[model samples]
Target: MEGISRTYPGRMHIAAMHPSTQEKSWMTALQHLKRKGAIMALAFLSTTTLVSAAEVTYERLLNPEPGNWLTNNRTYDGNRYSPLDEINRDTVKGLKVAFTVPLAPPSVGAGSFSSSLQGTPLVEDGIMYMSDGWGRVYRIDMTKGDRGFINWIMDPQTDPEFATGILNNRGVALYGNNIYSLSPDGAFIATDKETGEVKFRVETQQNPAEYFSMAPLAINGKIIIGPAGGDGPMRGRLEARDPETGDLIWTFYTVPGEGEAGHETWENNAWETGGSATWVTGSFNVARNELVWGIGQPYPAYSPKERPGDNLYSNSTVALDADTGKLKWHFQYTPNDSWDFDEVGSQQLYNAKVNGEDQLLLGHFGRNGFFYNLDGTNGAYVNGEQYVDRVTWTKGLDPKTGKPVEYTPNGGVQTYLPETRLDASVFTTEGADKSYCPFIEGGVNMFPTTYSPRTKLVYGLAIQGCAFNQAAIPEDEYLTGSVSAVDTATGKVAKRLDLTSAPKGGAFSTAGGLVFGTSANGDLYALDDETLERVWTFNVGTMIDAPPMTFQINGKQYIAVAVGPGGVGMNFEKYPARAKDENAKSMANFQQASTLYVFSL
Candidate 1:
């Protein structure tokens, strides 16, 4: 019983799965599985009754037990809000660190950019599953509440030489009898949950520029995966595969093909490599059978003239049919984008009353510095507002259409505030007087936002300041952070809490009347859900660049997050003296560590 068997059951070996160089070793492993799986499956069933955990069903994902953190962003609404209330406003004052588990070494040389803990750890039953930057999955036994011990680890052994982009493995997925994950180089691997044996490994990387970073979203017996590196010369796509056998089901390319519906948006053959990467975990609406995902910036992000016309899918939110991967509806937030504003964040789905009528809405914090609420069913513009300090790119959204005021009717290229945009034709002192507003990172970028049904307010952590275009500085241009609580019903900010550090780390709300957030520095704190007042705080001694999550165990609730210091940020590198506020100064120093910290009352 102690060491029964570890062979993959019903292991599969698909022809031409891996690279040709590794085919021999792979076939050797497949032969071993074929030879030993039959005997080992029997041995596993007959021993000590240490059976594997139950499969994660679609119903469970829809209505997950309050204690278990099932899917990424919990139940797929992209609302990181938990129903657990054991540690409420009255009890959070006594919350403290319960335990810690060390993970793989942080930011090893996996790519050109270093890695960090940009993932949200997933918890099930009493055990925990998460991935480090290098795609090593850790299975930690947490049934013993006092501490967590590593039960097993499954490493994909991704080659850093071929991993070209960021090394951030945002986490993994749990399905039938296995855990699913993507290596840095883009190999999708499935591991047996109970024994840590790999069931199958499918090569997903198509080119060196295309890499996997976000966690896989498993829903309705299919796993959805896409790649990053849209900034490079790579065409982005989203693929849905059969979870059990890793068989490709369907593909949705962000940059439409020549004969596709939206292909006319690109004048030249830019669609071949026009980048609109899908890099974030999307939300699933079970009732509507829709998968809502956000798309990234177009290639040559800062220079939109190279690719004319309003890029079809870049800087947009597209809803697709969950079963067929067919695009249902799309709403482009920034058209012909020239601000490096990639809308590849979260597309939160929620129902709220608008103008005295109940409406299902898709809310988003645009990287171009705006808050938008669109009709969920058809992607129609419902409401829009400027949540950040200012947006210099455009005057504002048109009241009727929600498009930028400067957007032309049928012009091939957009000229939204040439003073703030990067254009070669502009020649004016006004253009020289200002750089860009809300910075290129936006009101919020890849870091997630939270929508609390309890408060009916969507909270977004945003970098509130602006950026200079080409080293030209305006005295007022600076960088800072703000958490804007936008009223979901009205699409207006209810409250804005200014913070001392730019919140690269995201936020999550709880039914306990709290919103937990991490700082670019080292502080993790809880805020009153309604008032946005800091109620409690703890510094992990290193920066937290991951989203904080909560789960309950044995009638007790614990808050968790993946933490480490270095990331691709201004703080991670040396900067000149421009705007030295508490936010900028504190970000200058941080120790490096990759750890899982759990806290409870």
Candidate 2:
């Protein structure tokens, strides 16, 4: 009985029962166990859970709303096309200035913000996110008032000293719940897009003298950013970091490092400070998982002797592994570049039929006077041709190599001159006027050309002029700068439209058979996509060096362009061809104009 008592249920004690009666207790215990099991089963069935992560689709990214501006070029195809035909060719002439953000000079010597509104606004739902020249973000409510009103303003201008005098933020990138932007001094700031509240800010690059001015480009939950120290002694590098935590995922230096594949191209440790930083925006192809971006040139503006070899990745369109930041392939447009013509134009990615196969294409109007269409899959040169008349560096590029042979050898480093600006104490070498056509200032300065998929033609505005001085550096100093285009199918120039004024503010081609671009003379013209003839024009009364962006709001087509003076184009505007001064100022009078002009029909 004592032994059996050890297993008895405490609450069901039967002190006076016989040993055989324990069977009855066991039966009661079994009943209790059954009740517990049933209760547990009922609890388990009551709870239902999902075990899959949420998915983000391209359809969610590219909304179907005609009022939305989805991708950077208005669409991933980079045509800068808006299908909102409510303001078609018939009604575009009646397009009137709907609203204007008036301007007042920021601080003196803050660099001319005068009309320097370079950002291409992004519209979603009913909100317009636009950046002014001074790194100021304004949220305009397209649905607020009957005509729309300012919802809120985010002014990131606390430190006026850190200003590069150019409020050149291209715009902001929206991912998940945050909006990312880069300050003039290189801080990547995140803000709540819905509310004008600052979430966080971190320095992407740190150099007081070397400024950083570009909008954050987000891809695959990472914010990819690079510095803009083209005039400094540092080589540029591209970086990918966590958009929320600011943790670095990977980095791809424009120039190779020690014992790396492209390290042999650099002279000494010049590749260490080589300038291929991408200051503009980049594009990604989700299906291929490749981020396509144009690398800037090695700096020093004029001298190439400091940095040598083909400068592997500089002035090249690089296809990088989005997951690992490893360089998959690169097509260098200008090697051993001395011209400030950075390959850093906005790289546009798309897919079309080529040779009867659906091939991915990446296009750009290289500052060095050419338009290219390369296989986005492996960086293969599919098509390339001259888009300018005054490209004296080479007759043309070898289709197989995608390089200009004669121009590839001598990278415009003017080593022939005596070491006049050498700092022996620091072992630093600096030379003057050692660059060829299209100096580091660019035949086209910081302007982008758009490729229209609808017309099957790439549209670009080019400068016809040539640089006066050239560095007779070496056959290895391949420095040539100019603007040009190419037919993707044949890699031939369909036509070359060269302007007396250099191309500023990139080009935009639309699906409505129109191409829009701004010039240094403060004139904005729309070209017929098929004929490349002027269709419409507007004078903003100041130079424009920003890419124009278009979208549809409320069934009305709207066009917007940022105008900023004190750019290289301002030099030609103030001092025309007949301006009498041998030692004329290359950079015209600095004036500050900070405003955004919106027109619609």
Candidate 3:
């Protein structure tokens, strides 16, 4: 009875039952095949004419309905904004937890690195499609607002010996009759959306250190996927595959090969293992026919001295021809970055009037501590500003070019504020604490940000503190959290909210005039879109790692977020505590579990 005995918060899990033998190696994958099989059997016995449900056609994805969250970002532009206003500010006060579905127990076996839920769930009609760390996709029937029924689950059955360690999958993609996702071990899987049967599985990992985590971006007939594990010695590349057969269509290597256009930017052959991981999903500029995606920093993180020159694609926003996977243009954010400034965050696409003319723009809250607004069509830098309070990386950005004032043109190794560089500290010989602004994880790294069309403000969960033992900061503001509301037009911060704990969990906005976010201390809260005031809050008593998403069913709107702290960095273990963060101390002791939560008003 131990397999399914892992009940919901109160009663026995309404899903299934299994013996203690199931939880040994990993959580027993107590398959609910019987229930799904019975449903199929009943369908055959019924004689009445039955109309097949709708399929996820390209046209529907191009124009998603307000009642359903069709994509991970809810739209191709990655605004993460929902137009449903049923649960406005006034009615939001009455919002309460509607249902909770516990996921498969995280594996802790021999090659496992503590699996967790870090991906956003997709909702269509009233069914929720999500996957666990082990690449087990679950089809949950959420037609009943009060509870959720696990209809079926498709386990990829990855090999335990060669199972990827970091089993975090960002999310899954939906196209036609299939649901797509990549296992941590690099198995690109296409599963039947209705029956939970895998249609095809393609091996994409070239080596053991080339796993995947990002959710595939499905556009029209192509599924876009990129390799991860870039922190190790592996070249990163993005591939376009046929959704039906999982065959490669084209490839775009993040690191330029020898004799390639940007290959000269890398010196000493550092481009081979250069890390420019595209581990997060990006935006698609439909009008421009460009797929705008953010890239990560180079390998040997925090030690740029090992790799000279300005890494071209790393720390950049590359606009690629969506149909051909050909790089059209690119804009590098951090040149020769030494602070682990991975720019794999949001590439939020929006339109705004610039100088009396409307222009398609790309807005991003850079991990290097700036809010940038670039031309979405050609990757041109329009404007940007520092969103975080303290930044010592450089004096400031150049007003005209948007590059750092200290940045040198055609320079191999850069020395931007010498004092802030990892001076002979840990990068050289032994170890020494070095001071730097915007702690190593960065202003925001891979966490989804929100762009509210109503307020014209891009909200980001920002860490407003520094690292190193010798840095000088006020007692109250040594290391803390912040919510930066940057104007989409000017790229300037309009309102900033400082919180007691780090707001690590991501956020999303709704036409209801609310911005829903989560804290590392296990808090889910809603803020007024304009004023940025906390209107509601609910603590699940466990840290949250994924962002909040919104959808509507039965003429009623719902708010959803995956909760659990199976990942690290929630507790400040690396940098010593300066001022006591609100939930830092206790959150370290909190139990880790995978559970999906839904809310309704």
Cα lDDT of all candidates, in order?
0.79, 0.59, 0.77
Instruction: Give a tens-digit lDDT track for model 1, residues 500-582.
Output: 56677799999999999886657798999999999999988666778899987788899998886545653332221223454
TM-score of 2: 0.78
| Candidate 3 residue lDDT tens string, 1-601 | 1001111111112233442553432233322331221111110011212222489998988999888888879899988999999888999999999999988777642343666678889989888888777677777778778888777676655555445456667889989988898877667778777765566667677756666778888898899998777666777788888887888888888989997888888888999988787788888888878888988878766667788889879999999998898899998988988877888888999988776778888999999888899988888889889988789989889877889899998757899998788633333443344667886667877889999999989999987677554333345544567898988888889998887766766889998899998876678999999999999999988777788898877888888888756545433322213324654555566677789999998
Number of colliding residue pairs in each model: 0, 33, 3
Pairs in steric clash, model 1:
none
Candidate 2 global CA lDDT score: 0.59
What TM-score number comes out for model 3?
0.88
What does the lDDT read for residue 279 in candidate 1? 86
Residue ranges of candidate 3 with Cα displaced over 4 Å: 1-52, 109-112, 160-165, 423-431, 469-479, 570-583
lDDT score of residue 497 within candidate 1: 95
Per-candidate TM-score against the hidden true structure:
0.89, 0.78, 0.88
Query: Least lDDT summed over 10 consecutive residues: which range in candidate 3?
Result: 1-10
Give the higher-lDDT candidate: 1 or 2: 1
218 Cα displacement, candidate 3 (Å): 0.6
Q: Stretches of candidate 2 above 4 Å error?
A: 1-59, 62-64, 107-115, 144-148, 158-167, 352-358, 407-435, 438-445, 469-486, 496-500, 571-591
